[model samples]
Target: MQMSQIVTNFFDACVFFPRIIFFSGLLSLSGCSNAVEFVQIFTGNNGPTGPNLYHFENKEQLDLSWVKSAMSRSDYEKVLSRIDFKRQVLIAVSVGERDSVSENVQISRISLVPVADDTIVDVSVRVGMVSKECEKNLTSYVFVLGTFEKPKKTLSYGGFDMDNFNAGCIAELSGQPNGP
Candidate 1:
């Protein structure tokens, strides 16, 4: 079989496989810190029913090891060797004309916290923003971030690609288009 065919089969097996994380609503997910494959982070404007929003893309990568460090759990890192995720957030979003919506502004780091009222994880994002809209026009819009299940209204860090990259460098070595 061709290399693409093999890759397709492998992804088909892993992507469609039934691997589940134990979650109890939006606040509680067992492996939000571990290597769960997430295709997108759900953030919206005007709550779940709003105008401004971000979409998911395949190019953007997730450094959970880096993303997880922002979490309040140091011991978790001890179990698995961790990497420093200073500003390396590779998440792709479908922001059409709203390029200015979250442009130059990247919510690179995130953490999961326990909500006192319920057994759920509250999502916190550490954003690095430099938007012209936020400067001159002073346009005001609420930017929502993170993933969730609508029926249960539960947010999660699952459904992402946490595989090793930079091997990645192979793309460069092969003279392939590998910038970004």
Candidate 2:
């Protein structure tokens, strides 16, 4: 080991007891941090980060529609774009006097597991939704997101809209992106 490593080892041996107590204390703080994150994960926070939920103005009361069921690869691409971006575009499916969604449920985040044989892949999405109207009130749901590819497929999507409501699939993102 290098001289610095030797010094570190000496300290590690000498101060192991004290360090353990310190680390234990930090772990408690970590639990609190994780609790906050858990709340955030389900409820979502207001910003251009984390999962994407469709939000739009209630312009003369519009109709926000959910994405259609997927039947092919193109369907996956369409759904992926809505959930992948921070500020997503929305399309109005229902014609109404109010916004497509009076209260929007942002899928703050989600995790997916796919089970498939040789010819077909069926996936279950563990989706977390926070009301855009009330961010603290978070709800989680398990959506059978129709069918799609295996987890190994690399996908890319940007933005789409139908009414003011935003709903769709997701792709794992690295870090986060700032709007252009």
TM-scores of all predicted structures? 0.24, 0.17
Most accurate candidate by TM-score: 1
**Tens-digit per-residue lDDT, 9-103, candidate 2:** 77544322211112212321111000001111111111122223332222221122232221234643554443423222222111111211223
Local accuracy by lDDT, each model: 0.28, 0.24
Show where candidate 1 strays beyond 4 Å. 1-39, 42-118, 131-134, 148-180
Clashes of 2: 11
- On the 0 to 100 scale, the lDDT of residue 58 in model 2 is 27
- State the RMSD for candidate 2: 18.7
Query: Residue by residue across 1-180, what tens digits does model 1's lDDT show?
Result: 999999887665433323334444433334323122322333322221122222221112332222222222453343223222231222322111122232222333223322323222222233222333333322222232343222122233322221111121111100111112
TM-score of 1: 0.24
**In candidate 2, residue 35 scores what lDDT?**
6
